[model samples]
Structure formats: C-alpha cells, structure tokens
Target: MCGIVGVVSHQPVNQLLYDALLLLQHRGQDAAGIATNHSSMFAMHKANGLVRDVFRTRNMRTLQGNSGIGHCRYPTAGSSSEEEAQPFYVNAPFGITLAHNGNLTNWEQLKEEMFKNDRRHINTDSDSEVLLNVLAHEIQKATVDISIDAETIFQAVTVLMRRVRGGYAAVAQIAGVGLLAFRDPYGIRPLCLGINETEQGNEYLIASESVALEGMGFRFVRDIAPGETVFIDNDKQLHTRQCADNPSLNPCVFEFVYLARPDSVIDGASVYSTRLKMGEYLAKKIQREGLADDIDVVMPIPDSSRPAAIQLALALGKEYREGFIKNRYIGRTFIMPGQAARKKSVRQKLNAIPDEFKDKVVLLVDDSIVRGTTSREIVQMARDSGAKKVIFASAAPPVIYPNVYGIDMPTRDELIAHGRTVEEVCREITADALVYQDIEALKQAISDVNPELTSFEASCFDGVYITGDVSREYLDKLENERNNPTKAAKPEDAGRSQLNLNLANEG
Candidate 1:
C-alpha cells in the first residue's frame, strides 16, 4: 500500500532515498518522507504531498548520510497531515528513524494494551508510529546497546516480534549502527534487496519492490522472506533472524488485479502477464457463460487495460482498438482522496473517440471497477462515440466490498455492486451487458505463474478476510457500524483501514 526504502553504504546515501522515492511514487502519492543517520546524527523531514512536491529538487540532498530510509505513505491508521507522517523519530537512549509499508491488523488492541501497561504513548493514530514504538520499546528492553551493530538489532527485532501481529515491510536506521529491514511472517508484501558496486565498496539497498532497486542503479539480490529480518551494521555485516513462517503463501491478489505497477513482478509473477491471463480467462468464461460474441472489436479503457484487451482480442479473434484516451495530466482518482475529488477526476480523466467505435459492437476491458461511477462515465462516453453496443468486462470481479488497506475505497454505499446483482449493475452503469472473470479463473491465472501460491487475500470481491485484520465476527461488527454511522468507531480512529493485509499467516 506504500513504498519504503533503506540503504547502508560507506558514503552518503540520502540521494539514494530520493531516487528510490521517485521510483516508488506510483505506490503512494499522499505523503513522502526521508530520514538518515550519518555518523550518529539523525535528520528527518515528512510532509503531506507527492514525493516531488514534498521534497523539492534542492532538498533531495539535504539529509546527507551513509544510512537512510524513505517512505511514500498510504495512510492505514493515520491522517493526511504531517503530524501522522512517517520517518518517526523516537528520541531517547538512542534515536531511530523508521518508515513502513503495509498495515498492522491488531493495531487497536495493541494500542490499548500499550496504554494499559503504559509502555508507550499513542499519538496521531498511525500504525507506523505504533510499530516504531514497539521497536523502540524492544530496544530499551535489551541490556546491550542495539545502536552499535547488526546482531543487537536482530536480537531486538526478534523480541519485538513477540508483541505484534499483522503485516509489516519496514526499514529503519539505528544511530551509530546501520540500516535494518524486515517483512511479516506471511510474506504478504514484497521486499527486495540490492547491492551497488561502488568504488568505496559495496552499498546495500532494500526496497518494497524490485523496480525501485533497478531505478536506483542497484543489482537485485533476492527477496527478504516473511518472518525474516536482515540487519546491516556499520561494519557492513548482514545478520539474519527468523520469527515465524507460513510456507503457504497467500499474498494479496489485488496486487496483480490492479494495485501494483505492470512492470513490477510481485512474488515472482509478472504483473503484465497475469493481467493478460485475466483477459484470456475472461474470453473463455464469456464463451462458457453463453454470451453473444458478435463484437466487432475489443477496446481497452486505456493504460492498464491495454495488454489485457490485446490478449482478449487475440483469444476472440476480434480486432483490438484504442477507444479511449486518458488525460495524462489527470491524476489517479484514488490519489485525490474524498468523494468530491473522485467524482471530479472521473469527469476529467478520460475521453473517447467517436471514430473508433462508430456503428461497432465495442467490448470494453478494464482492470477493476472500484465504484460504478467511472464505468458509468465510460459507458456514456462510448455511447457518445456512436458505439452500437457497449459490453463491459472487468478483468477482476465486481468490487462489492470497500478496500480499507490503502486504495481509499470506503463505505458500502460507495460500491454500486454492494447490494446489486451483476445484471442490475450493468443497468446502473448503462452498459448492454457485463461479464466479469470468474473468481476461480482469476485465481488460476495468477497462481499459474512461477513459485505457486495456494491462497491469497481476495476479500475485495468475495467479502472474505483471509489474513490481516477483519474476522467474520469483526465483519459483522463492521456491517453493523456501517449501517449505524452514529454508533460506528470514529473514522479517524478506525483500525479497519488495514483490511486483511497479512491474514495469510494467521493459522
């Protein structure tokens, strides 16, 4: 849901954070922060906005240091203000600058427990801050100074593991020591390590995704496995520790469905390939479901659906056409946040060409439909373009449930498919008909890739939380809360922001 980076080198590495943030800006756009520790001195800066907007061109090199970490935040349990921003500095016996991606499921309970014991203070309601407190408390528990070496950090982290639950892909800088990185037991999120062969020596870099490493001119090493923590000390020694591991990998299926970048490979699967497979599967599913295949052409919604539409066209032996052109200047709807911004963005985000669909049966393919509004707008555009018939196809199933993880989808009323059938949804969106890829087919398409996974969090479609936060009982509680907003938990303090982020390892 966010991007995080860490670097440990012989020379200054603050620029590494800047470059890495540039690469990961697509992952999160709400806020950006960078922190560094050079010769035991810590410096940090965080603000609400895009990476470029938060850290100006001149300020990129401000936090000069050999050890550093950066975060592009997608708030899980935090506000869209600088107060909740990351790179949290907990000043005490020693300092730690930490940034994180992914949300913790048991945050509310943990915070209450922390208050019960008075072990830590809860501020801003950000899970990242809670995680920082956990690590800081763990460090304080140790007899040896954890700020000096990798072994001490590993030991501290192993102890901290006993206190927390849910997912985390974190990078932290410990003064006079080094940089540390780790992922949760389920390996629900991706983390990659790389090394830069520099004249000074070997500089190690870690990021949430491999693409960031490539962008930073670092050679990809390998993934940092779930339940494993890696520490790089001042001496540049890498120490490893294990907390727990659930070999049955059930990563969030939405990563391939729509969240991750096409060029990025998540859990060893090419995102582009998986998207194409969704198209191929949908093509066959349409045939099985006994739908008319008299479409003159297959059209993509543009950008994300380009590859998928091509695969669909090839499978159906229909011509592929670019029916819509996105306004590159319009930012993503989710990034804008709030309902008014989303509605406004939808109107300005896309444009349709009449020549492409005149008198033809246009089959529309898209990654996923968050709210039915955009699809409705696209349908109107298609009609205005003179398409005789517009058939909608979603590569993933209908989004009936709101995503609390980081996608900014909230409330059942916002989801047009929440209580409506697919047929009814088609009517609502003003489409002739709508066909979604079968859930099983979607699973096969993604799992067919290398390093197979048994299960994944697909709660967005089926309303089932396999891992991070919500349980069936909790889901019922949520439904109750949604029905009675007056009785619901305060939106600002709601822990539901996490969704089921790391549930694959719950068993």
Candidate 2:
C-alpha cells in the first residue's frame, strides 16, 4: 500500500505537501516523492526514504508550485528502485503527473497493452507508471490539447475505470487544466476529499486517509464515492462525476485491522472503535474457547494493537500491561521488504519488559499474524523474559489468502495459515495457546458500530476477492514475480541503513 496526497491552493504547496506526507509516512516507508505544477511546468523530486529524509530545503525550493501532489510508496507492484519512485510524470496528455494508493491486478496486461496498442513504453516495473500512461493515453485520445474540459477529463476516467481492474485511489495533475482524482469501482481502497477555506480562497486536497486532511487543518468533507471522479479546475472549481453505474463500497477490512492508523476514519467507520470492538469480540472468543482462565496478564505488542489490547483486558477482567516496548526510531517490521530483513528488524523494533512478563502467564495480543515469523519471535522474547507461559491472540481472523488489492502479501506460500490448521500454526509459532477471532465475529465487530459500512473486502480471511477476478493461476504468476531474484532488489537488501534515495533527476 501507499499514501497519496494532492492539493490545489492559492499559495505554494511544497510545505503543505511535506507536512501531509509526514502524517501518511506510516502508510509507506519505502520511498517518497513530490511533484508540483508551476504555470504548467512540472518539477518533481523523488527518493527512496521516509518523507523527512527525502525532502530538504533545497529540494522543496526547487519544487515550486501552488498545486502539487506527493506520495509515500510501499512496493506492492514494483521493485525497490529509485526509478520506481512516484508521482509518475508523463510529458504527453498535457504533462500529467499521477500518484495512487493500491495495486492493479491486471498491471502486466495493461503494461503490454500500453506498449502494443497505445504505443507507450513503460520504463519502470511500477504499476503507478503504467496507470499514469493509461490515463494519459485515454486523455490524449479524447483531446490532444494542453487543456481539457471537465467533461473530457471525466470521459477519460470512465475509460480508465473500464480498463483497470483492482483497487486504486488516484490523484493526478493535468498541467494547464486542472487536478483530477478517482476511486475504483469496488472502493477497495480509502480516499477522501477535504477543503480548507481561507480569506484568499478555498483550497482542495485529496488524501488516502482522513487523518492527513484533519492534521493539515482542513475540513473533513465526505469520502469520494466508488468509481467517482472529482476534477478541480485552475479556478479551484470542483466538478464531480460518478463514472461507474453500479459501484460497491466495500473498503478493505484489513485497513481496520492493521493498515490504517487508529485516529483515522475510513468509509464512515471509526478505525479506533472498530479495533476496540474487535478486542471485545476476541474476549468473547477467548471465553468461549476456555483460554481466559489460564491468562494472568494481557500484554500488547505495542503501538497499533494497544487499543485492542486495552479493550480485551477490560472485557476479560485481566491485568493490562505494556509488556513490549517499541523503539520509535525503527521502521515497522511488517512493511519491511524481505523475510530476513523483517525478522532481523523485529528484535530491534521491540523489546520485552522483563518485569511485566516475569513469572506471569502472558496473553500477547497483536493485530494479526501473517507469516508467523514475528509472532514466533515475540513468543520467544516473552519466554526469554521469564514468562511462565506465552499465549498469542490475534484481533483478526487467520490470513489464509494473499491480499492483492494493495497489501504486500501476494503469495499463498508465504502465509503461515495458508495450508495449516490453527493447532498446527500454534505449534509452529510455539505459543502455549493461540486464539484467533472468528470470521463472522470479525465482520460483526467492525460493522456493529457503523451500520452504513454493511460489507467489507475481507479477502485475506474469507479468501473472497470482492472484484471476483483473482484466480489460482493469477496468484501463481504474482508469486513468481515476487520471488524473481532479478526484480527483488529492495532498499534494505542494498544495505542502505538510512533507507533514503535522491531520484530528483530521474523525474
């Protein structure tokens, strides 16, 4: 997954984009980039690092514009190369620059189609680049002028919706014309519109999460509807069109479980409340499974799981303790590129509090266990901290399938629960007892609080892709691509300790 932000304002947006990217840094840490349009002249600077490390005063000064877009990239569709960093730009179709959150399942086919049919050559393996070329091609077909009207822009988006299959929340700048943003038909990824009204005028921003908007002192407007296009002209006028006839609003359930920040609201559902309910539901499950009696203390695997762990301890009437202390400086181990890197980072990222675990029957709660690597390491850490017993509980149900929408898990073989029973997984992780929330219970926990969010894209747990196009063959192909050594040179693999890249010239 990635975080994308766009702004159309009266003043220079370099600092505004930078501040917004800081809020979204959690969504992606692999790479960051910013592209701004100054009188139809595009200036872009992209690097392979966190937002703070990537952009400096010199770089921000070079990115001079009132309207701009920024991106924090997590490599789901491309290799970790500086060439793959986005806000992908194209000189054609009026110098369009695009950034997006989520992955396209049909990226390979679209890339081939762009080469063969559109006569466009994609330089990088990044799917966002392909998406940009696709949009540029469609827009060019509609009109070859430097400026296109809202109707023509919407028409191009309609064609894009027909061609691209999978989840995407995209924002693009049409140099001399306007700023355009769109969501996929399934609404599998999050995107929202915000407005900041000042004496000068009203500034518009589109972000992957509502938190970024709220953080930048913008009024929270409603979410951009599924398959909807919003075009903001140079005059700051807003135009909207629902391109898809029958669009479903099934946002990814994993967003609530782990991906999104607790402070954010996604698709009208409060992420914090959903996680609290998940813990309450898991408490019931623990009681039902008769595992509540053996637990002496409920300990959280710091940060993301704290809210759920607090709620779980409250419901179970157990002592709540912060057993693991996370190092704030370390990046998230889950988003690390490779298993070896993730495993190595786990120890540096979190350390057990020996006083909390000593002589205690500890029930360790985490958001979810994907590969079991981190879970096993945490269990071993608790044991090494002198815990009498270590029980692992997950707020989410088992992740048995690959999440092809935006998340990095693209292969079934990498999942610990893909072909194993709960007992077998527990044994593998070396937990005294493993408790996972039920699939139906997880759905109920998230939906009970928000009636409007009736359904979700629970593909990882239920193995049901809402798009209804994912197949075994397609999954195998994705796995092969993920495992290809030549294409798998991640930033961490290159021994870059700071994880920073300066690709200003490449853009």
Candidate 3:
C-alpha cells in the first residue's frame, strides 16, 4: 500500500504536499517522493526512506510549483529500491507524473503489451511505472492536437480502465494542463477529494484518506466515487466523469480492521465507528463462548486496536487497561518489509507494563493476527510479565488468504491461519486461549456503520477476490515467484540512498 496526494493551488504547493505526506506517513514508510509542475516542467525528488528523511530543505526548494503530487510508497509489487520510488514520470504526449496506491494484478501482462504492442519501454520493475506508461500511451492515443481537453482526458481514462485490472487509486499531474485523480471500478482502495478556499481562489486536494485533507486545513468534500475521474484544470476548474462502464462500492474491509486511521471516513463509513462495532460483535461471541468471566482485565495491543479494546471491555464489563507502552518512533510492524525486521521490532516497538499484567487474566486484543510473529512475541511478553493466563483476541476474522489488493501478505505459508484451525493457530502462537471475530460479524460491523455498504473486498478474511480475476493458477504463480528468488526481479544496487530526476526542464 501507498499514500498519494495531489494539489492544485494558487500558492506554492511544495510545503503543502510535504505536510500532507507527513499526515499519511502511517500508510507507507518504504519510500517517499514529490513531483511538481512549473510552467509545464516537472521537477521530482524521490528516495527510499521516510518522508522527512527523503526530502531535505534543499530538495524542497528545488520543487517549485503551484500544482503537484506526493507519494509515500510501501513496496507490494516491486523491489525496495530508490529507482522504484514514485511519482513515476513519463514525457510523452504531454508530460505526466503519476503516484499510484494499489497493486496491479495484470501488470506483467500490461508491461509486455506496452513493450510489444504500444512500443513503450518500462525501465523499472515497479508496477507504478508500468501504470504510468499505460496512461501516457492512452493519452497519446486520445489527443489529436497540441493541447488536450477534459473530454479527451476522460476518454483516455475510460479506455485505460478497460485495460487495467486491479484495485487502484491514482493521482497524476499533466504538465501545465491539470491535476487528475481516479479510483478503480471496485472502489477497493480509499481516495477522497478536499477543497481549501483561499483568498486568491479555490484549491483542490486529493489524497488516500480524509485525515490528510483535514490535517492540511482542507475541508473534506467527499470520497472520489468508484471508477470516477476528476480533473482540476490550470484555471482551477473542476470537471468530473464516470469513466468505467460499471462501478460498485466495495472498499476493502481491512481498512477498518487495520489499514486506515480510525479517525478517517471511507465510503460514508466511519473507520472508528466500524471498529467499535467489531468490538461489540466480538464481545457477543466471547459471551456466548463463556470466556468473558475468565478474563480479569482487557488490554489493547496499542494504537490501532485501542478503539476495539475499549468497546470490547465496556461490553464485557471488564476493566480496560493499557498494558503495552508503544514507542512513538517505531514504524508499524505489519507494514515492515521482512519477517526478521518485524520480529526484531516488536520488543523495540512496545514494552510490557508488569503492574497491569501481573497476577491478572490478561486478554490482549489486537486488530488481527497475520503471520503470528508479533502475536507470539507479545504473548511471551505477557507471560514473562507474570500473567496467569494470556487469552488473545482479534477484532477481525482470521486472515487465511493473501491480500492481493495492496497489503504485503502474499503467501499462505506466511499467514498463520491459512491452513490451520483456531486451536492449531492458538497452539502455534502459544496463547492460553484464542478468540477470533466471526466473518459475518466482521461484515456486519462495517455495514452497521453504513447500510449502503453491503459489500466489501474482504479477500484476506474470506478468500473471495472481488475483482474476479484471481484464480487458483494465479495464486500458485504468485506463490512460486515469491518463493523462488531466481524468478523474481533482482534488486538494484543499494549504494545510493536517493535519486532526483528532472522529468522536464532543469531551469
């Protein structure tokens, strides 16, 4: 997953994009980049690091423009190299710089098509680069003259939608023309529109979440609808069109269970509210199983699970305690690249408060258990803290399938619950008892927040790919490629920490 933001403003947007990227730092930490368009010239600086580390004051000063896009990238589809860092730039049929947030399921096929049919060559292994080339090619086909119009842009998007297969939300800056943003037909990823009314004129912002908009002093307008394209022209005029033949609302349920910030709202559903509802549902199940009475105190794993833990404790008539003290500096372990990095970071990320766990029947509530690396380490921590019995609970259902949309869970072997029963997984994690929220309850938790949202991309939990393209053969191919390193793309040299490319003019 990645965080992408675009702005069309009267004032310089370099600082604005930087601030917005800071707000979305939780979404991605692998790499960060910003691309700005000045007088139809694009200036870009990107590197494999956090947003703050990637852009220096000198780098920021060079990125001069009123309209631009920023991206914080988490590598789900490519090598973790500076070359793979986005906003990828293509200088054909009008310069275009795109920062995308979603995995393209058909990227390899599209890349081959681009090379053989479209005569376009993709330089990097990043799917975002392939996506950019596709957009540039479509725009080249759509435009007949030197200048392009909103109708032509929408037409190109319509055709592009027909070709690309995946869940993606993207923001692109078209030279001096406009800032464009669009979401996939399934609405599997979150993207919203915001507006800031300045003394000079109106400024538009599009981002991965609503929090970025509100944090940057822009009022949340609404979510960019599924398969809808919105363009903000050079004069700040807004034009919109439904670019897909058929569109549906199926935002990823993992966003509420874990991915998104609780304060943000997606597709008219409040993430915080949905998580609380999940707690209520999980509480009901625990009561049915007669496990509520055995728990003396309920403790959240910290941060994202706090809302659910609070509501669950309230429902179970138990005391809610903060047993783990989280380190503010540590990045989220779930999004961390490797198993070794994630395992090592658990202790560094959170410390156990012995007073809270000592002599207590501690029930620890986490958002979900993916690989069981963190859960096992955390359970051992509770035992070492003198807890009588450690009962682990998840606010979400078991993640038995790989999330191909944007998350990093790629293989069944990596998922603890993929081929194991609850008891088997509980034994593996070394927890005294394990209670998982039911799948139906998980869906109801979100639907209760917004009745209109009757469906979701719950692929990881239910193993149902909403895109209808992921078959058994496709999954097997993915697993084979991941396990066999020789089949995967070799990583570039790790000597340089950053790369700054001038896609347009230097001066």
Give the candidate number with the greatest TM-score. Answer: 3
What is candidate 2's lDDT per residue for 236-310, written digit by digit as tens?
999999998679899899999998999999988899999999999999999999999989999988788888899
For all candidates, the clash counts are 4, 0, 0
Model 3 Cα shift for residue 207 (angstroms): 0.3
Off by over 4 Å in 3: 488-507
Give TM per candidate: 0.91, 0.95, 0.96
Once superposed on the true structure, which residue ranges of model 2 sit more than 4 Å away at CA?
144-147, 485-507
Query: In model 3, where is the ten-residue run with the lowest total lDDT?
Result: 498-507
How much is the lDDT of residue 25 in candidate 1? 79
Query: Relative to the unseen true structure, what is the C-alpha lDDT of residue 441 in candidate 1, on a scale of 0 to 100?
Result: 83
- Best-performing candidate as measured by lDDT: 3
Cα displacement (angstroms), candidate 1, residue 273, comes to 1.4
Q: Cα lDDT of model 3 overall? A: 0.92
Clash pairs for candidate 3? none
Candidate 1 per-residue C-alpha lDDT over 146-175 given as tens digits, one digit per residue, 9 for 90 to 100: 334555666778766666665578998878
Candidates sorted by TM-score, best first: 3, 2, 1
Q: Rank the candidates by lDDT, best first.
A: 3, 2, 1
All candidates' lDDT scores?
0.77, 0.89, 0.92
- Cα-based RMSD of the predictions, in order? 3.7, 7.1, 7.5
Question: Of the candidates numbered 1 and 3, which has the greater TM-score value?
Answer: 3
